[model samples]
Target: MAQVLEFKLPDLGEGLTEAEIVRWLVQVGDVVAIDQPVVEVETAKAMVEVPCPYGGVVTARFGEEGAELPVGAPLLTVAVGASAADTPGPGEVPARDGRQDPPASVNGNSRPAAADAPGGAAEGSGNVLVGYGTGTAPARRRRVRPAAPATPASSAPPARPSPVPPAPAPTVAAVPGQDASRGEGPVPVISPLVRRLARENGLDLRELHGSGPDGLILRADVEYALRAAAAQGRTAQAQAVVAAAPAVAEPQPAVPASAVAPGGTRVPLKGVRGAVADKLSRSRREIPDATCWVDADATELMRARAAMNASGGPKISLLALLARICTAALARFPELNSTVDTAAREVVRLDHVHLGFAAQTERGLVVPVVRDAHTRDAEGLTAEMARLTEAARTGTLTPAQLTGGTFTLNNYGVFGVDGSTPIINHPEAAMLGVGRIVPKPWVHEGELAVRQVVQLSLTFDHRVCDGGTAGGFLRYVADCVEQPAVLLRSL
Candidate 1:
């Protein structure tokens, strides 16, 4: 006798309510061990692998890949008791003329053997997380069926339980090599999710040739078809726009549809992109922000970096040196190292600096925060920043690493931009932007000289500080850049 137990999606924490099924790691009839990961799901915060706590044979799976399921929704069902190889498997279910008949008992009671007894408990891992635990297992005694009346020597064995699901009869209309568009046959798709995806995208399933086993259609094939359709539609629209433009005697090639098309493709802002959009929009809607910038002579700062590298402990990066400068500046002007509590209507001044820096990756722009950055030296900051950058690039950053910043440092110089009026990272009162360091002609002690100069921009919440405090912070940062020795006073 086996007990079928249902497993639901677990609470992934961090206030996430739903997740998109990225992939399935197990299938029906596969035996799984306790704590084995069964699926990969993508939440708004990160990609996570969910582990099943039950060690049993998978009987059925509820959702398909790419389906967005809410927390606590049924994930899968597992049959517990005996292994498939040890007991009668699903394929052994008795059938006559392709029709299943209930098992007959020797006493003619027709009762299952296991149901007559009680008080047998299935063992399970004591995992206490959502959708886990041993509490759901059945408590019953396993029973054996009595000998049945002798009939033919090859008579069917006594029926235990039906392990196999009923199979749908094959359609006679649709045969191999028949065109699906003619409605002669059913579309060959295995997963219901693939059918739903094609229907939602207005795709004609018959037109697509399945690349899976036995010409079975797959989800990836449907996605590829949608992409191709979208691309072709955009190309046609672009050509029409170009042809409609008035022609001059000497005409230039018409602008692309991406540049001039009335409406272009719209990508849904979800996941990391959506999180960024919400935060930025909130920052803009709620915070009264102001920007200030100044050009600093970084020749001495460059010289200091070269000297440090020459000393050869660990090669110090320019960003680390700037971070060291930022901590010192925040120390001098503590007003910018705080957030405004809107609910309390009070300015909350933070004592420690959890500095966040903007790093761009294939996913999107992410701010990886460094804890207690004010306590770290240049070498320490360099190591931590390098680790975070690599994690961001690989899309392995946890939610904790991406949050809880008291201030932000953005190095947009890597993009070759000279200046930008940056938006303050919300909840944090200020952000420091460092632009490109280029050789520019400047007066060095009243004499014109080519110096390594960098533009520094500061955006701050006006509610927390006035123009004077913001100016003082920016000026102190600039002084440190002009002469690295200025940082030694605070250090």
Candidate 2:
């Protein structure tokens, strides 16, 4: 009989519960060797492809494309030991329904599902690996459209494994008129219904400002703007027409705004707004945060970064440098390198720093972690940070990458905000916000002179670190940024 094997979901590392299936590398009825990849899974951090350990005929699929499967769930079943009963060409999807019968005694080509456990895939089927999934039901299709990418720095340390999280389904924006499947002209900023309403009402939305995230013109905003414009147009036309109709030259009375009320109903905080609120609340409620900012001269650091990038042996970034410095400081003051041990009676310090860079993905804010950042110096950190950020932007980041950050860094200077005290990433103690560096008046050497200044905010948890440590750490960061050479020296 064909030896059956069940492939379970992998742990996905960093305590991930579920992952989105980005792509399927293999299909059914194809004879495969051991350790061949089956699918590419998108975790919070980076995209990882899970390899199949057994060589057998594919029989069933537990989840579909774009489906999120929980950890330890049964992913697929394989019948091993038999030669290819049938070999389907590439790109052919196999039957997800379990209906295949077991063949007569065949070699045990299937890999064990899990060590010291039951027979694979309910016995006598395809070759598959075990321990790849959770036994629970398949995860929902909810999605996370990661927000714009920026550096996310933390002020505290790391804790151990957190609880099993619900799979955050990757979300596509509520686009107008355009279906996202074809990858056509920017996912419509507005929803389909909103687009229809705007069209029926002869709306010119180009002039109105977009209040939605990513500059998307919301339905309500568009409707309101349209009605106002139409109302004004009608009133002006009436005034002119009325004035011309009467040779008496009587002044036209002003029409009230209510006349333009093409009013429609709205659902608040149920879509993207709700997601934003949840993320904001989570950031505030769970993270013990305190923000403090300082202005530092960035003329030298900017010059240094330019020179390095121009030289191009390996390109680096200002954010990368900041991440490296933060890691170094966290190393010195290990107290800041910790996670809140919610179960335990205290905060648990991390042995290594997994730095989080706040990525502004189009969907929402995704903080992808740079594991063991302390081990990587300037160049490595820069490359890794750049790679992760790019991956995050492209929606290629996996779950592991999105989780496990001891601290977070957010650089709002790119948006030209001079200064802002950022909210903390939950479970982590602190975050560092890098503001705009502009030439401003300052007393250098007791003389009033203009110097390139940058605002750095290091928000931390007061429970684990006292003002002394926090201040010192922030000063160390400021010193590093003030003098680029200092970072090289510290390294």
Candidate 3:
């Protein structure tokens, strides 16, 4: 007799609460081997592909594409013993502690699980649906970083006067007007972006003067310092980076004359795109919305990215950078980090930055949650982003990766668009839209020349986030991108 098992969505890590089905790699009735990727899922950090916990003939597809499922929700059923050599042992206990289990006895060293059994390990051990399990289940323990919002990088904007410069040499301050200290002291007001830039490039803000409004150091000043310092580090490296995504599909204009109505093929919208349409329409009508934007040039950031990759760092996408930047900006604008409390008739401000990265999958548009992005550094963020994006593309994303985001980032620059105004994910007060970076003529050292330019769009709730705060937040982000070093100070 064939034994049956139920597979449920497990925590994908970083406290993910839900995930949306991007697509199913295997169809019903397809025989699947243990650890064979069965589905692709979209989480906040990235797209992920999930392997089957139990090998068997897929008997049922319990969830639909574009559907958001909770942790432990039944996903599908598999018949473990349908074929010879696939039979389960009598009285086989479901993996009680799959996390602590060893590999199976099979020569392939697979982890074995009776696919049709109940309460199968949601995350799965090495042994699964195949007659035998292979490899150990991936480690389940996650590294926990200290809980604190990241500080914004202060370098994306044009340079301003230093409003908070330190005393030159300490000795000059005690004896005024004796040497270089004789001139008006350099302003020291540094934005989050500037502080980070200073640290990364070993720049002393006191050495360079800011010319921005109110003495705030803009990204230009940092770039200048970086140029003066690097010579080589800035130009030899450049790579593609992430930015915000724009609005929905445009209205169809006149149909092309070449194709007469033999009849337009009716493609049913399901999955990620379909889900995005449903939820975004609902949000537009039900939730009050507003937006603000600031252009950002990530030229320096692109350089930094190249340097990091060359140094054997994780391969990170531009989406990861926007997520990290927004995580930092949220700390200075916490009101945007909130949810609408239907039961309380008030907004609940979230202490942690549960960030959502909007991803497109065959199923539809889904926003996956990254529990606390502020806690992760660039390397960690890069790794998680890869994992999530892979899961999304492969149809194995877990349900928990889809829920509870305090803010969302929609990046479209991957396709090479310049900019767009993205909608806010409901309940959260704001969303960030990033666009492609292109070369533009900009003034450097008081001379006009080509530099990288990009645009940013910020949509926020009118009730909670005001224009000034939202605008300031965008400015903060812009400053960081233009001057990648600002991240050092914020950390």
**The candidate that achieves the highest lDDT relative to the unseen native structure:** 1
Cα lDDT tens digits for candidate 3, 1-491: 67677566767785555566767787656689998888776654346777778987765444445544545555666777685234322223324344443332222112222333222222222111122222211222221211212222321221223336622211101122323421343333322334567668766654554444222345555665555334323222211111122333322223223234544676633334555666678778766887777766677888877787788745766677777788888887888888777677787888998888876776456676777888987677777877777676665566567766788888777768867767677767788888778898877669988888888888888777678888888888888898877766777
Q: RMSD, each candidate, Å? A: 16.5, 18.9, 31.4
Runs in model 1 lying further than 4 Å from the true structure = 1-7, 26-36, 54-59, 77-263
- Writing each residue's lDDT as its tens digit, candidate 2 over 1-491 gives 56668777778776555566667776655677789888887654456779888888765554455544556656666667755554222233333343322211112112222222121222211122222222211112112233422222221111112245522211222333333332322222333345557568765333333444323456546655554455555556666777788654533334434334545555444322343466669867766667677788877788888998898688887888888889878877888878677677688888988888877777566778898888887799888988888887786676666776888888888889888877777778888889888899988878998888999888888777887888888899998887877776666
Q: TM-score rank, highest first?
A: 1, 2, 3
Please give each candidate's TM-score: 0.63, 0.54, 0.50
How many backbone clashes does every candidate have?
Answer: 3, 75, 100
Off by over 4 Å in 3: 1-266, 362-364
Sort by lDDT, top down from the best: 1, 2, 3
Question: Which of the two candidates, 2 or 3, achieves a greater lDDT against the reference?
Answer: 2
| Cα distance off (Å), candidate 3, residue 129 | 26
- For model 3 the local lDDT of residue 163 reads 39
